[model samples]
Structure formats: structure tokens, C-alpha cells
Target: MTDSSAAPLRGGAVGIVTATLAVAAHGMAGGGWADGSALALLIVVSIGIGAMTALPERSTVLLLPALMAGQLLAHIALSLGAAEMHNHSLLPSTAMIAFHAAASVIAGLMIAAAERLYGPITSIVRAVLALLTPLPDGSAVGRVSMSVAVPSVDGTALDWVISRRGPPVSVY
Candidate 1:
């Protein structure tokens, strides 16, 4: 995709992916499902992060930190919105932290790899499609058909021709 056209898509994809991974990681770490308000907050924060990430040129290095930061922010939002909480502290337990970190790294790597491969994959798909498209019939290749207007003549002149194996033949 061209840089200009790709920005919005990349931004949206990054935001959504980060937010989703954050929620999933929280659940996997036994954080339970986030409430509606928390989910809303996560979405907003993720969008902001995504917009920021999209401004720069495409790079896996830049995206990694943005994803990680977005995940962390989302986790905080989730923690704050919970009605009943297990951990009273500001930070989660070491195990939970580790889980989120691992999830972020894995997800970030996969997303980055996909971004890298997207250009090549699209080109290949286009090439295949071009090859698959039907061509004009062979019989129509040499066929000639046309009309012309003669202003000098009182009636409109008709000029047409047909092509066969021998030579050009005027039909009118």
C-alpha cells in the first residue's frame, strides 16, 4: 500500500490489535473481563496511540513500543474500572505483569511480521489476478469495424470494412 493510503488502515489496525491484545492478556492473567466503562476508555486510549504510531514511517521497532505502552495503559484502565478487585496495589502481581509482557511481545512480533510481508503478498496476489483475467477472443483480433461522417456529401456516408484470411473487404 502507498504511504498516504496506508496511514489510516495501519493506525486503525494497530489501535484495535493493541486494545484487543490488552483485554485478552488481562483475561489470561486472571484479571477477569473489563466493565463497559473500562472498555470504552481502552478504546479511546488505543486510538490515540494508534494515531501517534501512524505518523511515523512504517517500522517494526517503533510499533513495538507503541503497542506495549498502549497495552500497559489499557491494563491500568481495566484495573481502575473494576468493581471488585483482587489486587489492591497500583501494580499487578509479578506473574500477571510477566503474562502481559509476554503476550505483548508475541503479538507485536506477529503484527510486525505481517506488516513486513504485506507489500510482497499484495504484489503477488495482483500478479496472479492479472494472469487469471480472460483475454479477448482470437477471432476478434483482426476484425475491423468503424464509421465516418462526410460533411461535403448531402447524405451521411457509410464506410465499413471486414477482415478475413485474404485481405480487407469494404462492406459499404
Candidate 2:
């Protein structure tokens, strides 16, 4: 992806993660879920994502949920704006709040699940390869293949095995 795209993409990731933390924390504070349970689930989901990201080439799996959730947010913003202008009703806005939150969390968990469903490492490799589209006489996909390459070595290998895939990756 272009730098412009990558930058926003990274931001989307950070936003989702931070958003997840905030909501989970809010849920905990609200006493909606057991103090530890909500946090625990969040941690597990985070760890699951990270673990799945680590597999040799499954890093792309990590982006799936982020992208999905990001798109959801973008769409929500657009529709919310229209709704706010037209209906003057808080319904869509309120639904966006609830649905967006749930969707993001679900997206995160689904990303983790995708990693598990398909070996992270292996899936990542496939994702990368998918970017290297072979030349054709002329085609859109062939014209734009830009998947980031997955590397063999990643930070603190063993810790990564157990660590949650959050930002600020440890340098090893």
C-alpha cells in the first residue's frame, strides 16, 4: 500500500485497539461484566490476535478485522452524518454507537479466529504472495498488488508466542 494508505491503515489499527481498551474498561467500570472477565476477554482477544499475527506469514490475518472494523467505522460516520441531517433522530447515531462497538470487538475476535482457522504464519505468507500479482496483458488486480512482505524474524520470539499483538512491537 502507498504510504498515505499505510499511515491511515496503521492509525485505524491503533484506533481499534485503543477503542477496544476504552470500551472494555468502560464495561468493567459499568459493572456490566466481572471486573476480571471483561479485561480477561480483551487480553485473550488481543493475545490471540498477536499470536496469530506471529505465525510465519499470517500477519495479513491480523489486518482483516482491523480493516473490517475500520470500514464499519467509516460507513457509520457517513451514514450517521446523513441520518443526523435528515431524520434529526438519534436512532442511527445511537445504533452506530452500539453496533460500532460490538462490530469492532467482533472484528477483532474474528481476526483472531481467522488466524487460528488458518495458520497465521502460513496465512500471512499467502497474503503476501497475493500481493505479488503476476503481470497480465492488462488487469486491475495485476496493476495494483501491494502486500507487505512477511519476515522470518520477529521480536522476542517466545514472548511473541504468548504475547498479544499490540502496537510498539518489542525490538529484539
Compare the candidates by TM-score and give the number of the best one.
1
Q: What is the C-alpha lDDT of each candidate?
A: 0.74, 0.45
- Best-performing candidate as measured by lDDT: 1
Off by over 4 Å in 2: 1-73, 80-85, 88-92, 120-172
Instruction: Please list all clashing residue pairs in model 2, or write none if there are none.
Output: 50-165, 55-121, 56-121, 57-121, 57-124, 57-125, 58-120, 58-124
Q: For each candidate, what TM-score against the reference?
A: 0.69, 0.26
User: Per-residue alpha-carbon lDDT of model 1 for 1-172, expressed as tens digits?
Assistant: 3334455666777798878887888888888888778888888888888898777465556777888788888888888777476364547767668877887788777766666676778889989988999677778767888997555463333323333368678899
Indicate the TM-score of model 2: 0.26
Give the alpha carbon lDDT tens digit for every residue of 34-139 in model 2: 2334344444444444343344433444465643444343433333434323333322344444655666566666544533444455668888887897445564
Looking at model 1, the pairs that clash are none
lDDT of 2: 0.45
